[model samples]
Target: MASQKPRILQDTRDMSWSLIPLVLLCLIIAGVASQCSFSPGGPSAGPVPTFDIDAGLEYDAKELGFPIRHPEAPEGWQANSGSRSIITGEEGGDSSTVGFITPAGRYVRFTQSDAGEAELVRFVAGESRTATDTREIDGRDWVVYGEEDAEPLWVADFGDVRILIGGSGDEAELTTFATAVGEAQPLEP
Candidate 1:
């Protein structure tokens, strides 16, 4: 019985050794799965949203009682999300926001809000002060704000409606988006 102990131990060690490769294979599979990103369609987890910027703009225009502007983005620039946002509380109003993936792979959002002048500047540019510089796009005057090194927030108001163009960009990229929004209007479907 005493001598059987060595034989039993040897059998156990052999069994453990046999399982080592299987364990390593399982670990390898886990590692690969962890690194794998399952973006089924595109940016989102599920099927990527094919945001209809024109349709959203049309709806917002009707709802806001104003012609909400939208961009006719160049090739490779796709709209990721587009919706109308309603401001809550006493300052109740609506805004249209469309998130876009720029051709340069940068994110830029075009927001047209019915907020007050101060609120429009504050909401987009945060605490940043408006720059003295300005630009004209498609016959519309746009006021520029934000640091020189960062993406500047451009604002232009038509009566009670305030249009803000901002997001990841330098002056050039910001200008590009502003131009697109100013020049283009969503055609009827």
Candidate 2:
């Protein structure tokens, strides 16, 4: 056993060797980072799904036991989706919903339910929102809820059924869809 160098010096050399793996890891990470690119907006959305409002309304009308109206697709607008959902809370019932993509690429969702106006508003715009104003669309009074926000909800009572329309479009675009839906004849269930 030749006299070994001081334990501290021997340990220092071992420590330096131990750092090699960490250095390599750092270099690998740097290389990966250099090759990585970021998109601030993230991935783009795919095309909207095609939905047939006629068949859906027929089914919903029979199943939901309520009147379901199908608005004629406005120019450059299309029905992208439709579904049936149960309205929860005190006014528990089924609802039929149809989503349209406007000409400007904005979305408007139309929901028809037998639920009361308050429950419909609560379901559509949340409990925190309240009736802000009223908009007359095609001689029909559409109660505006949460109008101060970017997307406001418009609810109209059509006798036994209540219709709620809300979306990302501006007033004009929303009004256009509302008018179409309001003026359209109810589909025979």
Best by TM-score: 2
Residues 16-47 of candidate 2 have per-residue lDDT tens digits of 89899999898889878896446698977678
Q: In model 2, what lDDT does residue 59 have?
A: 88
Q: After superposition, how far is residue 33 of candidate 1 from its true place, in Å?
A: 6.7
Clashes counted in candidate 2 amount to 0
TM-scores, each model vs. reference: 0.65, 0.75
Q: Rate the local accuracy (lDDT) of all candidates.
A: 0.71, 0.83
Query: Lowest-scoring 10 consecutive residues by lDDT in candidate 1?
Result: 41-50
**lDDT by residue (tens digit), candidate 1, 64-173:** 75556655786777888986666543444677788877666677778888776566666556563756678997788988776766676788876656778778855677
